[model samples]
Target: MEASITFGDDALAARAAEAARELAAAGVPEALAAGDPTLWGPAAESQAADRLGWLDLPTTSRSLLPRLAELAERAREQEVEHVVLAGMGGSSLAAEVICASADVPLTVLDTTDPAQVRRVLADRPERTLVVLASKSGTTVETDAHRRLYERAFRDAGIDPATRILVVTDPGSPLEQTGIESGYTVVQADPRVGGRYSALSAFGLVPSALAGADVARLLDEAAEVRPLLALPEGNPGLELGAALGAAALAGRDKLVLDASLSATTGLPDWIEQLVAESTGKQGRGILPVAGGEPTGVPDEIVAGIATDGAVRADGPLGAQFLVWEYATAIAGRMLGVDPFDQPNVAEAKDGTARILAEAGEGPLPTGAPVLVDGPVEAYGDLPADVKDLSGALTWLLSAIPERGYLAVTAFLDREAAFEVPVPPDASFEVLTDIWAAHDAATLQGLLAVRTDRPVTFGWGPRYLHSTGQYHKGGPQDGVFLQITGDVPDDLPVPGRPYTLGRLQLAQALGDLDALRGRGRPAVRLHLTDREAGVRHLLAAAREV
Candidate 1:
């Protein structure tokens, strides 16, 4: 019997097949034809070259190059003051990358916060240009902001079409909206996903307009392409597949995201792609990203590092303990299935509500009323909300959710009296205490403060509001520093700090400086000798 034959795009097939063979030869088992579907995909392998082949994708993204050039020219002529980018996820990531890399005066409003939107608009004049970006054009968040801006333009008696630019797929709701509104619609590449679209014009145009050397960036991306596609020798594909394989082998996968901005947005895009695409079947990877930016210089790491130190023993018993887990998270993103933690969303919602209540209205500041069970833990909690903190953590531990515990203190009677005390105000007071106690513990502690059971965060959503709180708040918090001090030391790599040490130091120091004015400070060092760190964490339950 003859084998059934499939034929179409013969040239494409041949090129992809040759590329696959090279990948296999280079040691990419995923490139090899395996019966296990988790190990490979013809579509992914097939698109490898073409995706990276674009002349413009390296410095500028494929999704936004041409339009950026046009916008730049227009800006030069129109003397445009501000460029407001609208969208979320991929739609915004590309623009963010471009703006970060560009020379233009740009601001990306990638939030659902009405106050944030009002602030951006209020900061800029009515003439500022708005770029409404959405891959599907149906994103509710983007649309909400669009409505606000559309009203602004209409009220100012400006032609909305000339002032607004829309980026979206053809035939999407956003495209229809732009068309009906008489706005210019720049169609994104139909085949490009949001994360992958960064190399497309989607990200490049805005970045270039903001003053980044987009062409050079694309050049760099292009340079990496050939290297990435080189069979087993290709670092990108090889690294990716190997990491995935390692996770599949039961090793913990962790991605140490040492980027300047902890939640700057790039990691989110990469995380999604790595997680959704690679995590197939029940046996896939478990991806995670960690940062301990407490010891290094703030400016160097975009201000993530500060004064906190990892403990000799405790939660962060050793830098390696966290490192190994980080490696596991990276592996999981690649394809390893780390034990899945549960109820992430519910925990986030509770945290949000807490923040919102504190920021918007009267907080429940009664006093620590510890009850039996989980309430007895966290000995140094305040009288007003001690139970709240313990209850939040207990609920988080009880289920699968993303929980975070923060204890802020205001030593200055004046500062404490400041209007609008947040519900978690006391939590902030303990920042240095937590950071000093155990930077790792503080990190993990925050990960467990939820009304619902929490395991870990699926993405970086919770980190968005942390920066402003760390930097802009009144000097009234001594954060507890915690870290597992096992594995002795981390490789410092030519610099004054190891990647791990740098992370821990910077994060701690910044918190220290933020509240060092008059507040008393304390640092706790959690020992990670043996399973002592976990034991301490478990002991918290008994507290």
Candidate 2:
């Protein structure tokens, strides 16, 4: 498929056309391509100056091809065929999409769940090459992952320098760490923001190392790069105008359906790009990914298969470029800075404070108001609401018109848990937790009760992604968070807290951040994940 976009129905198309016309008159595309930072006004000019490097990444990122090829060849020569990616948010999402769309195998470790970490460690670490990616070079999750992989390689009697590849900005702490430890470090373009780094080293390096066609990806992106600077008939501008116009018209819920695209996980990457980039300043677009939405007035489906108002059909690389361009334009229209994620650090700070306050035990949280079977419901459950179904219904009731429900899961996302099923449970939840099916199930369950869109995000991982939007964007969102008891908790190497503790802190931290922002949110802890999943599933079905 070629890289391009199609405007939606009559009203949306007209609105988009008018918005695009306004943008053309204002010289949005030209200014963006010329790296003029003043397009975003005074509030964002400084960041805009530094963050527009992505505009040229389609060509500039090609410089890394040789080094990436060398890394791939080394991995082959060393008999290290397995690729494990340890990154969060933008650091990993782009690579994750690239490898997935290319049908290559790259194990993504974007979580702090002990079971998840344990599963990664159990993989063939001896022959696994771990790509440690962190834009800030100081992310706790990436550092913990680096420590574990280092220890794992050491325990397996392998030199970590041969197995560790570091990706970060130059002069960052991770680059220094990689250099001090004799590991190869690929520094991404410092001027590129994390979410917009799809065509840069951060996205290209890991995918190249994992045997994806990095060159072809770059070629595809380059094929569509020129259109981004065009005034009219530009796919990026058209799509962005449609998005901004819709949001401005109170149809801010963006339901993305990339089923028609050649890329498998484009919607997810776009979700982060748009949500993080636009969802701020007390107003932003909310991306409802991977569902069949009815296309309510507050919702616009950006489907690839002609199923929506904004049809974004493109090859993987081109899709990334277009989405980045469109999200930037949308950010300009929405009156927010697309480059900086202002509220992302709120959850991290909360996690730190929680970890510091909790000492060695479970993160301190107020007791669950209701415990039904294996499920423990935290958050505001009305005194009269006794069952899990009732709690879910109450949360659903909190979702306002033009608002959305965000279902976040903090559990080990396994394909299948081998735990014994509880006899009293209504049914078995066999497959959702691993793929975050439980959260999705609850999302759909709650979705049917209201016309509003519902979104599902994996925990701590989302903290680096949509957590910014949840805290900083519109105040109409209602949240349902799922976290469970980690019986076999694993500790971070040389750290006081376990991965389980870190995961819990992240969950509670985000929960508090949402609550502190006056957003209605709740946490449901599964006492016995298997039984809890079963109960949660059954209760959601009832809700």
Candidate 3:
């Protein structure tokens, strides 16, 4: 359960050593441990003061044990052992890993895709416990989810108050709504920021309900927590120095090696934490959730697997605490406020504007420049491009030397892709092909074709995570947004727009925000999900 870090390369080791020397000389570790908000300078002091409570979460969060246990027991007694968590960003990511590591069931609903939403509704509501989590209580996606679930439960003749649980900061908009609706509301530490709340109530509540060993996680974190205070020997500080050093040295793209985490999906959590915290003022670390990608000279390999110098090994709790601390340290080194996401609102505003302009008409889905079988391309394309292969090649060529290509898919992530391996094919081939069965295939295909990092995320979920970095971070990024025509668009219970429209608007909103910033962006509309994905896979492979 002890967390540890070691260097595997001379460059990383030397750079980390230099960074550690400077930080130690400035008494940074001690200042951070002492809760000195001024360490981030006068500009960040006010926000830092309200965001440092995470440092104490390992021990302070233990008080929630009895409450979490009682809720779990109550759910079991009611034959509602299934836990459906509706949250975005850090609120859900922490609990996700916790449950995955423990081999428990947790259904996470963090998307605006109606297909994903409908899939969750198919789960028997009477036997489910829905946890509504949002720090601000006003996140458009979370709010929409809350409204849908409340209706779903009521339709099942189950009182939402009995089946629902809420987690948010005290005085948050959700807290008031939860109280008014007569649901159990667990107020988290307001001082802890969303991404740093891995050890707080936001993390423990859903995980404990889903049968994770919540107390043991805290114990593991507590054991490694004290070492974070030592400037030189601290694992967190060392990792931070290495990360900062790597980014400053022009290797800012972090390719995650999942060999260490296995099924825990720790890299996905780390991706949001680092990207959102450090990406600001036209600078940030872009986390690529994949193993050591070849040919990207600007890529830095780190995570559980591989012999990378910047790696972490430990239990989930210790892993969470160390990464949170390291990200804060990296933020300081990057000269940005780790607590604030300055540009996250741009897409939100765009989404609202697009929705408002929709009025009583159809959502504003712009015209596509090229339409090939089941695939339509939006945004300006290179002249004389005849087919999907040509279009993909042009998109790959748009990425700058140190820039990255991002693929955001507004589709169901869990849709089954049953790849039938040939009798002569190896198991590895089956698994590999299954991975490329969706728009996500673009990441691997495009990475091998270009000398830049490629990142892929299921949409709307990322709008609350890496979406901050995409627009606010380094301006060198080129984006590929993939949207599909929904087979059956479901309407929002009380809202005017359907889930399909909302998702398309979310995609359209992001396209506007990225293009407005002068970033090269394109949209690929999948006219048919299965056919489009296959065509996409084939075309991307050719790129």
Best by lDDT: 3
Candidate 3 has its poorest 10 consecutive residues by lDDT at: 414-423
TM-scores of the candidates are: 0.52, 0.96, 0.96
| Clashing pairs in model 2, backbone N/Cα/C closer than 3 A | 8-309, 413-434, 414-434, 432-437
Which residues of candidate 3, in runs, are more than 4 Å off? 417-433
Best by TM-score: 3
RMSD of 3: 2.1
Tens digit of lDDT per residue, candidate 1, span 1-543? 110112132332343345435446544433221112222234333343333222223433444556678777876575667878877665665556445434345787765433345556665555478888887676545665677776677677776777788888779998898999898777766655554566555665556655666665555455544333334433333233334334433432223342443224443344434443333333333233343322211100111111111111111111111122222323334433221212222323443344455553433233323543222222233445344334434433433222122332111112112234346657666553333333144244553332311112211221222222222222222333322232434332233332233223333333334333333322223333223333434544443
Q: Over all chains combined, what TM-score does candidate 3 have?
A: 0.96
Estimate every model's Cα lDDT from 0 to 1.
0.41, 0.85, 0.86
Over 4 Å off, model 2: 415-438
Residue-level lDDT tens digits of model 3 in 1-543: 468887777888899999998998999998888788997789999999999999999879999998888998899899986799999998899899888889999999888888778889878888989999999888888888888888888898999999989999999999999999999999999999999998899899999999989999899899988888897679899999989998999888888886746447888899999999988999899998853467456777886744675777777788888888888889899999988999988888998899999887878787888988999998878769878888888878888878888889988876634445577878788677677675676677777887778888888888888999998899998888899999898877788788888898889998899999888888999998878888988988776
lDDT of the structure predicted as candidate 1: 0.41
RMSD after CA superposition, every candidate = 17.4, 3.0, 2.1
Once fitted onto the true fold, the runs of candidate 1 whose alpha carbons sit more than 4 angstroms away are 1-67, 101-105, 259-265, 279-287, 293-386, 395-543
